[model samples]
Target: MTEDFINYYRENISKKSQIIKGVNDFLVWGKSQKINFAICTNKMESLAKNFLKKLILLSFLIILQVLIPLNIENQIQDI
Candidate 1:
């Protein structure tokens, strides 16, 4: 699994066109194979969405290195 992930990253860096093509292929394969996907992170949904938006805006930015500032007070809500 680690090797497969590393290969994916290497392929992504080595050629963008290839990376996109491979991603599309993988998606197709996953769908055909009835694979269920889920992303689990410690980050809240709002923060994750905001970070994704920033990443789209600046493709050059290293996503892993980008820090999303969260307002803890606002994040907490009373029901």
Candidate 2:
């Protein structure tokens, strides 16, 4: 079941935007309800932290991609 969930996420929801949005929504809902959240993955703490950092970076990149044209075209014009 764990593998299946991971596979489904990899195949259908690999985009960082999706991951970030899902996590963000969950956190917001949890906070509103005063619910504490904890991650229980089998992954090591370092690995999990790295994964989360990557997701955050990807989400930030996606946001920049959308906003750069309007706000910083001069900086990223080469790309």
lDDT of each: 0.42, 0.44
lDDT of 1 by residue, 2-79 (tens): 446544544443243233446546655775777654444444344444444443422222333323245643543211
Candidate 2: residue pairs that collide: none
Model 2 bad stretches (over 4 Å): 1-17, 20-23, 56-79
TM-score of each: 0.32, 0.38
Go through the candidates in order and give the C-alpha RMSD of each one to the true structure.
Answer: 13.9, 14.8
Query: Model 2 compared with the native: what TM-score?
Result: 0.38
Which consecutive 10 residues in model 1 have the weakest lDDT in total?
Answer: 57-66
Evaluate residue 77 in candidate 2 and report its C-alpha lDDT on the 0 to 100 scale: 35
Query: How does residue 66 of candidate 1 score in lDDT?
Result: 22
Task: Specify the highest-lDDT model's number.
Answer: 2
For candidate 1, list the clashing residue pairs, or say none: none
